[model samples]
Target: MQNSSPPKMNATEQAYHGIRNDILTGRLKEGERLTETRLSDDLGLSRTPIREAIGRLILEGFIERQSGYTTRVAHFPEDEAEQVYEIRRLVECYSVQRAARLATEEDIAALRRIHAAMQADTPPRDQAAYQRLTEANEEFHRTIVAAARSPRLTALMTTALDVSMVVRTYSMFSEKDLRRSLNHHAELIDAIEARAPDWAASVMSAHLLAGAARVAARLKTAGSDDGQD
Candidate 1:
């Protein structure tokens, strides 16, 4: 008997996820030219799906088309980063506030479990932890947002996370930064457990803004180093 599990995703979705992951993980390199033929061969798909995937990524702000011929990974614009964080802070704070009001015992417990996983997977150095932590951190946020029960807000927040991963890959975090993030996650979990809506909301806002500031600083430092070299 051929073990018949459900058929996996078709080519277009596979191509989309593969290219998106490469861009998010910095393997594609910001501003590096992308050719459909090359990408199709590399990802082992045909040009049709690869083109469709690139179109989707462009729609998602992960890639850009230029000079009617060239496509490249999108670069992080500092101003755009600031704007994204500002919107994220506002939306996430509101989401967490509602989550605190709505979360049940199960919700709080699940959040704690997600955080525990994050704590356990301490990536050595900041090298690629950004990619590794994406799912865990996303689950942590999604739990709170889902508790709010607002589909519209959840959709918006999902887009925000996608954009954030792009910015995060360009900024390396220090050990102190990682620890601070862990502590903030703990505080958030405590606030949710206590059903402190105001406190949870405030902590979530601070956590996002603080992360944005750190990433922005890292970008600046990287820019200076590049100039020196």
Candidate 2:
């Protein structure tokens, strides 16, 4: 049976997750300044946790601290984004292949729950619902990674799955693209259920490539807009 207990988290850990989610969902935004004082006020917490969280984000490549006095959300540049997708494709292809061999029935069910939430005619309609969908997407991929049972592979993927690239890529997904992505998740689960590692890896590769293309286009559009401005 799966452990039903929630993992314990300190204030700093909680603050880290909260701020990370905001960054991933575009609530924080790329290139937006992050002031400890403003974050403390917005999060209704002390500066200590907020400060700690920012420090961690910097190390994780989600935020950048300029010199010693400035901080901002990490921007998704085309060059860096290409590297992120390339690494994700390599790592996740291996991860999903292993998951096909290792994932339990319960793991499949957990993934299905996330997939169901992403289906057609049921797109997220509010801020909270959108947050749920975004987090569900993250969980679906993380579950596959965990099922791989490779700590090193998981660690590598974590770096590539940085918030800037993830949010910027997901932000450009149109409603049609969103539905197709959900379809891909369903197909991936089917591949895993069939214990076809190659099939599962192929699906994951296509998913990452599509996301990379979306993010690249978004960067190009943003660049054009900036030139106009």
Candidate 3:
């Protein structure tokens, strides 16, 4: 049989994904300097690949350059986040509307499986468990996004979610809010199963806004303290 394994990532791909993952997961803090020399050493690649990766990151908004000079991880500005949320609201609502019409039994089952795995307790304050929680949360939403089956929409929303800072905000959700979010997930499944686009879109819209508000509040507080958000 011919080999079926996936192709190995090139050095530039490796460096790009490593740096991007750190930015998304908050391992690379906002405004932290991205020195090509350090990244080349850490990723065990040459400066050429690291430079390429940084360039990609700049184009994708994972990092930015000031006056096309110093490179650093991008901060999640409140205004920018709100603008992204508005775009997400439109994209995701349309997605759920489409998913409600299009999701197969297999798709519904897959979504349920992810939803069931989500933590019911207050998300752990620890780093590792929290990382898993973030992954699960992304999986839950991404499954639904995939169900919509629009490559263009998927790519657009993925960029927004990468910068949304949802994980940072979700970890700080009040117990009540966390429970409410989970309950909304369950109800969303019900709407999808019933193939009710209006119902599913409604739930998703409210769910997003609730989380956005919480994150905005956190950003406000952070601004008062150290401007981390």
Candidate 4:
């Protein structure tokens, strides 16, 4: 007899992408309980696929499953955020240093284009624009890191980027915050163009640390808001 073929994704992968996108874009708010039946009805899929998707998400750190209870969107734990930032600081600094050494004029030019596009758009203070800008910013950072041409560093940075996205989704920023971020990007680009490895590394480190500080403050503020209810 012929060997049986493995099942394709069917409903599970579809459900997984839908829920994952919702979480990443903040459509599913943090700490919101995910009911299998409700999600099944909404997505027009069976509970089995929804459950499987949730399981996958749990492994990916996007959702948390409690024993004999409902799963929920992952909450922004302050400690986790801090630790991720620390790791990001070290990895990104090294990546920027190497990038500064290896970056070509063409690479710098492409980054400039991305930066200009980011600055032109008046990102609305809503989750949608926030999500768009987040992706754009990731692209900008990825360009710099890619210049380094180190596969190991790239892999580690990619994981950190995912964690960073989770942190950012919970902590929304104001227009002022966005503008400040753009300014920093400009400075980083300038440093890179000057071929100043030390300066580029320092700027990238400070930029990442500043972002961590802002996110920490936002988390505290959000906590206070929750307590008021």
Which residue pairs collide, candidate 2? none
Name the weakest run of 10 consecutive residues (lDDT summed) in model 4: 163-172
Tens-place lDDT digits, model 2, residues 99-214: 99999999899989878876633476765576566667878888999888899988987877775566557767777778878888999999999999999999999998998888
* Model 1 worst lDDT window (10 residues): 163-172
> How good is model 3 by TM-score?
0.70
TM agreement with the true structure for every prediction: 0.76, 0.77, 0.70, 0.77
**What are the Cα lDDT values of the candidates?**
0.80, 0.84, 0.80, 0.80
lDDT of 4 by residue, 66-178 (tens): 77877989887888788887888899888888888899889899999988877866465555555566667888888988988899989998888774354354346667777
Give candidate 4 regions above 4 Å deviation.
1-29, 40-60, 68-70, 125-128, 163-171
* Number of the predicted model whose lDDT against the real structure is largest: 2
- Cα shift from native, residue 169, model 4 (Å): 4.7
Local accuracy of candidate 1 as per-residue lDDT tens digits, 1-229? 7978867989999898788878756688778999999999999999999999898888778888989879999887678778877887999999998888888889889988888877776653453455456567777878889988899998988887664454353235566776787788999989887889999988998898888888789778767876897
Q: Write the per-residue lDDT of candidate 3 for residues 1-229, one digit (tens) a residue.
A: 9999878999999998788767755678888998999888888999999999998888767788986568988777888777766777888898999899999899999988877766532354565455566677778788888998889879987776763355545665776787778888898899999999999999999998988887788778868877443
Off by over 4 Å in 2: 1-60, 120-122
lDDT of 1: 0.80
What lDDT is reached at residue 72 by model 4? 89
Clashes of 3: 0
